[model samples]
Target chain A: MSERRTPDVLPGYEPLGAAVRTDDERWPTASPDGRRRLDGLRCHPSAPVWTHECGDLLTPEDHAALDAWTDGLATDPPAGDDGPPPAVLERLDRLLAVVPFYRRLGVDRWEQLPTISRADLARAVADFVPVDADLSRVVQGTSSGSTGSALVIPWHPLDIARDLPLLEHLLSRCGITWPRDPSRLGLLNVVHQEQAFTYASTMTWRDEQLMSRVNLHPSAWTDLDHRAAFLSEVNPQVVSGSALTLMDYVDLGLPVTPLAFVSGAVDLSPAARSYVESRSGTTVLDLYGLRETGPVAAAYGSREGHHLLPRTIHVEVVDDAGRSLADGSAGEIVVTSLENPYLPLLRYRTGDRGALTGAGRDRRIVGLEGRAAVRFVTGDGRTVQSVELTQRLQQHGVRAWAVRQRADGSVLARCLGGNHPALREAFDRLLQQPVEVEPVSGPVALGPGKPRRFASELGQ
Target chain B: MSDPLTDPLDHSVEGPDLQAMIGRLLAIPPDFLAGDVEAGPLVNDAVRLAGVRPAGDEAVRARGLGELALPERLALQVGAWMVAGPPLAPLLRTAPGEGRSYDGESVASALLSFAGLADAVPVARWTGEDPERHEEVVRALCRVLGLRPRGETHGVAEDRWVAVGSAARRAALRAAAEEQRKAEELARRLAEKRAQEAAAQYTHV
Candidate 1:
């Protein structure tokens, strides 16, 4: 465990490889202050947990100390600092100078780099991965995209380790203490609880917070009762999941109450949020971030827009042409991720559309719409996002669905799982008109990118 | 899961060479079929270009080139059932998509910002979620149709996909049993605690 010797290959830890490219050695190598922080790894005072495999992440004790140490160097700028911090800009400039992808793209300046789409990254992700990466440390995955179109961004091991603090800061902003109360569990409901995606561990990396990540995708549980029982049993003080997932769980009619529920991963519709909040009696905190960039923003309490996570990443709203847009103007959300030296993406085009309100720490993305929004129009001209409607159906346990407004202006709903009459009645009621529900063997019209939730051929 | 017995798309396309029949009927040119063979165009990209539409009869028409075999019809059914799999797997000739491994978390975070839930599903980059029931459903359809889809297609017909189906079922049974055992253990512990508390109260009295 000596500093001179390379760290052991921890369960999830990846050792840095020898320098390949001239600047490769520059990666994972840190400044004197940064190197001092790495000393926390040697101290193993955290309690032993049966399932925890990695002992490398900074402990909460280390977090408090390091946070205090880095406050002057790395704290957020004043509330009125309109642009990215000078330090962020300078580091990004240095990152651009080194990352192979940016270098190959000839991105001498941040603005010189072209904004990338999810489709663009999906196409060139392999090329974007750094050549000098320590292969063992690299882990890859696709985005949690309903359209099934998202980036497969690779991350350096250090970037993964660095995420620990960002998560803590984001959770703190949400008003919930992290390494949460030992008595109340921190339940994480993710997309898959399948065996392969099973993450059974205490928060050994931080404080040994009793945390569990369950797959909310239904298959993870034996039945709905099982899901409810699992939640009631865990009775997490902090329940974090996509807004839709939280809604579905709440709709299960469980008596479980948590201190707060953090919502992200999907559009948090007012209806869904209210449904959960009214029933569960907990605040819904919307965390705005992307995997390519770690958590960059989170709303405090029931705040309308998310406060920017400028500490971990810098966010800007720009028009389609990549021209930076003024505050309050809706445009594409562009992020300059401060993490991930393995495959640094500067000016990465997040396909979501939103507007930044306020400045510096107060900045928040408003009107943020991910995926091209298509609305299902009722005969009476009332329109709602089909994605929203589909989520509503999912709340009723219908998966794999699509709603289309035919050329003749007839609303048709198709699904593979449940053709529940109540679900149909709900859809019809939403449209304020009678609609046909067709039980099908396969999905309805699924166009590229996001699932074409609402398709209209009536020349809308 | 599309039932082999009920689908009107069920046709005469069959035999051990189910992949070939599907390839021929759909008039799937090599470029379109390139992804299925794990060759040609990048899988995710090629998969988007050609595939059966979800529209009922139109999808059937696109899937079945005029006349069809039971095996071919089953393949289409299998393809339809694979809406939950990689987008390209539905179009590629029963082969899995190769470029990326994104489970629910990665896509979920991007689809919506669940940064807390990010890396909740690991991105093994170049890996696709291979749920056993999907393979089991494929195997079940194949068995009922009595036409063996090609083995090396990589998309749907992996060499051990059928085995995966059985293994998944076994794992499911084991999981259910394990779940029951855990519940019993918990109940026993609770009961023991209750008894201990009662004895303690009696002793205090």
Candidate 2:
């Protein structure tokens, strides 16, 4: 390939180099010899190919309302006051009317009924799959199995259709304006194996978007060389992955920086999010959702609440009795998959808890109050979020910790890696109840693979 | 069988042949591309646009690229590769089944980045002058530029692709050290801030 190297290529460029620095910078590539023939190498930035063309799926008013909702703006004359508007409820009704599982239940209606749990779904899993669709074409996916059991849900293309535009809307929050010409879009997942899939398996998905998905597990590549080569080659404008995977790169000190970073699955703490954002020089948008549900909520920025995708699904924050809680009160999160007829889930309990803010199309989950076990009941029966308890301990430099609410309502705890030499007085005063604190020697017993900030005698 | 005339990757001969090659590469006759019949022109554009202006120690110095010592030029070159390489390489390296193309603005940005890196690499070397520090610099440069300096491609050729693997084994170690340094400082600050907030909240409670 180097047989006939252009001799004096250096000398020739010297004048051009001088012109670049000292005067009217003549970009040498402007010359005919340097003319770039980039037709195949580059795409013309035309209309987006990634679009589902589903914007019209919404009634014009609903479409405009959705646009406004995603843009973080209020629609004119607001879609609804306290309850959802007619269009929103109709969408949910239409989606549920076709649910294979609902029809099989031999029930006239499922909404406002006892919420479905993972155990219930697993027991009747077959009923959820749409009766009309061919089994071959449907895509089956498994959940994270974090809450004791995993739900394997089968989805048709229509199930995933709302996701593309909804994601397009969420990603926009990170200041990532897409339809980027000459850009490679890359996704990373850390599956704890060496390499589950080869690097850069699929290429560009559109004329404007070149896509690559890579597993960033230690076993995936031979070494850093392979990791660097593959990732830098697929240099993405926006790098989206789990919080753990993003932290792995940050801790490894990999130098590649993307225009934006998006993380989902696990909760990203402010401290960890700060480290990654500072290290990568980009903002991290925490997209909160479940495997059964696609893109249910997202925090546009680190400190913001998880905003609900009101157009795609209807969300209800219900108390223990299945009664809907008003805005500002935390309760179990129940969601209905508004678009999936193949395997529809209505008022499914997510095991997570948060409060809703705003009304109708403007609704958002201000913040997740952690899982049910994270609740700390005060002596006067006041429920305090475990994150608040940890935040107090954290201020005192408590690095690693696990706080458990005993059956008697007292608190037993493990604290490690901080300046909490005396914890009982500090904690008891905080909880307004007697507290037992023991500094854990090794890693704290936070429970399961992923730890809960707070544990309880009662389960979620 | 492709004719040598249409082999757009060829840079073997110069003068009118080079001009003809460039013309062939740049000129994709509209009718010829009626039904994706411009594979030659397509490959030509990719090769031409992605081609770097490789330089050597002297040429690099002239352009104020290699004028700075060892790792500085290497560092500059690496930053450029991060820019140019990501956009161009993925299209060629990982062409999807659907064969999606990238837009020109992204292509131009990528090419310019490669150009920056290409110009910087002429004198991108370690002179064994300060073996300990020079070794560290070389390895850091390799990681920075996303180049795995191998035994096969490591030299200071004028206007040619070069990847000097001066002490490649220790490159990862050096990069790791730098990375740890950045993380350690931030981790410390985050922990302290968390502790403060926790303490205050507890007191209020």
TM-scores of the candidates in the order shown? 0.48, 0.44
Per-model DockQ against the true two-chain complex: 0.01, 0.01
Summed backbone clashes in each candidate are: 35, 15
Kindly list the per-residue Cα lDDT of model 2 for residues A1-460, writing each as its tens digit: 2122121121111211211121111111122221121222122232111101010111234334444544543232343435544545664544433333332222333342346656455554543443333443233444533322234455443343344345565566555765544545433323222212222211112221334334454333445466665565555666666665666566655556676677766666676688888887777777777767666777766446877654446677887766789888988887765455445666777767788887654568876745322457666654554534644564465555677888888888777656554456556554667687777674535543233356777441
lDDT of 1: 0.46
Fnat per predicted structure, each in turn: 0.00, 0.00
TM (B chain), model 1: 0.23
Q: Where is model 2 chain A poorest over a 10-residue stretch in terms of lDDT? A: A47-56
i-RMS for every candidate: 22.9, 28.5
Instruction: Write the residue-wise lDDT of candidate 1 on B1-205 in tens digits.
Output: 5432222222222223443333332333323211122111122222233242222334323332222221122233223223223332332334323332333222211112211111111111101244443334333334333233544343344344334544534543353344345434433432331211110000000
Off by over 4 Å in 1: A1-74, A78-81, A130-132, A144-150, A156-164, A190-196, A216-218, A222-225, A371-460, B1-205
Q: RMSD for each model, in Å, please?
A: 21.5, 30.7
Winning model by lDDT: 1
